[model samples]
Target: MRDYVQTAEEAARRAGHVLRAWSSKFTVREKSRSNLVTEADEAAQAAIHDFIHGRYPHHGFCGEEGLSVAGNDSTYRWVIDPLDGTTNYVHGFPYYSVSIGLECRGEMIVGAIFDPIHDEMFLAVRGEGATLNRRPLRCSAINQLDQALVIASLPVNTDRHDEAVRRFLSVLPVAQAVQRTGSAALNLANIAAGRVDGFWSTSLKPWDMAAGILLVEEAGGRISKIDGSAFQLEVPNLLASNGLALHEQLVAALV
Candidate 1:
């Protein structure tokens, strides 16, 4: 799967380049009241799709910028988020990334995430292993929720009455700490690298969680629905942890 890994990395890097080029001059628009999309997002997605589709002309494509292409093999597809943290990029927060994952028959077989600002590349192949910048990756061994640094994803413009906010509040006192990052992809990548102990989200799309799911699994983490049920990509209610004591505790807390 060297070619798969190489192509994913190259595509992600290409998108990252496009993001950087447009960073200084991009115009922003809202996808919703507080949800932002920018010219940079579209341009980076174009760059990513062009590079990947040129290599595998028949591979289906799904991207965050409303790009959808069906190749001859419907079972083989590339899921992409050209700019995983658009708000972060817009504000120069430097926490965004380009995420790409290859799925076969609804199962992710390869995944790659690239942080252009930091020049970090994370990759994983099913049953093989996960890596960060060519070095092996493993989840942190924190076994207890009280000692974990956990993160959650709440939708933009979320308020106190939102279910997501309720979930966040429930975990606030139980886990060591609870934080929110604008980028879910980066959060997952950090989990794989043993930098973050856990992450849970009830609001994320396929592109946001697709690649990172494989990365976490390969890095020795466990993933499931917030209530510890089987996770389905179509309806994302995910809770991912280091597969130690935090998993069950998180499930109980989230429920």
Candidate 2:
């Protein structure tokens, strides 16, 4: 497990470097109305795939940039989002990151998220707890919904855009504040680090939440579907919180 975590961290950092180098010069194309993908996203995923496949030839890989390797061993797969915040990166918003998660036999065993602009690496191994830059991390203890700071994402191109807006309206007045950070991976990492109290999103891919979800769970946070059901990687909607009393209220508000 430790080896897996180390490999993921290395891959994330290498991809982060690729992202930083191309941030200023990469060409962009629209994947959809408000969905953007840059040359850096592909390049960074290539760098990550090369590094991981070189080390673990038998392990499978699934990347957001369309790099998929069905290796000999199907039980160990790496889920990667080379650039989690392409729009933010393209606009110099500085909140983008490289997210990598290793799932072994249907369970996430190791995860790493690297924020190159801030030089922060968030890592976690199942049952071993989570950390930021090698220091232990814990979720915030804020138990009151009115005192909790929350974050969310509502991609304009998603089919659930209107539903997300309605959910946002429901949360706005009850929580301390609601923010849209454009990066679900970073939002989940923030929840793990206790930088924010909670996060929910109506649409997300496995690459967007795989790594960050492990970080939150290892850090003693809570994650579920919007209706408070168990969270599955394939499920697009999710709610993550600090495992405080406010979680129930937040879930109720989203209903």
List CA RMSD, all candidates: 0.8, 1.3
In model 1, the Cα lDDT at residue 79 comes to 95
Q: What TM-score fits each model?
A: 0.98, 0.97
Q: Kindly report which residue pairs in candidate 1 clash with one another.
A: none
Question: How many pairs in model 1 have backbone atoms within 3 A of each other, for residues 3 or more apart or on separate chains, i.e. clashes?
Answer: 0
The residue-by-residue lDDT of candidate 1 on 157-248, one tens digit each, is 89889999989999999889999988999999999999999999988999999999999999999989999989998897899998898899
Residues 109-214 of candidate 2 have per-residue lDDT tens digits of 9999999999999999999999999999999999998999999788666564488888998999999999998888889999999999999986899999999999
How high a TM-score does candidate 2 get?
A: 0.97
Those runs of model 2 whose alpha carbons end farther than 4 Å from true positions after fitting are 158-161
Q: Cα lDDT of model 1 overall? A: 0.93
Error of 2 at 55 (Å): 0.6
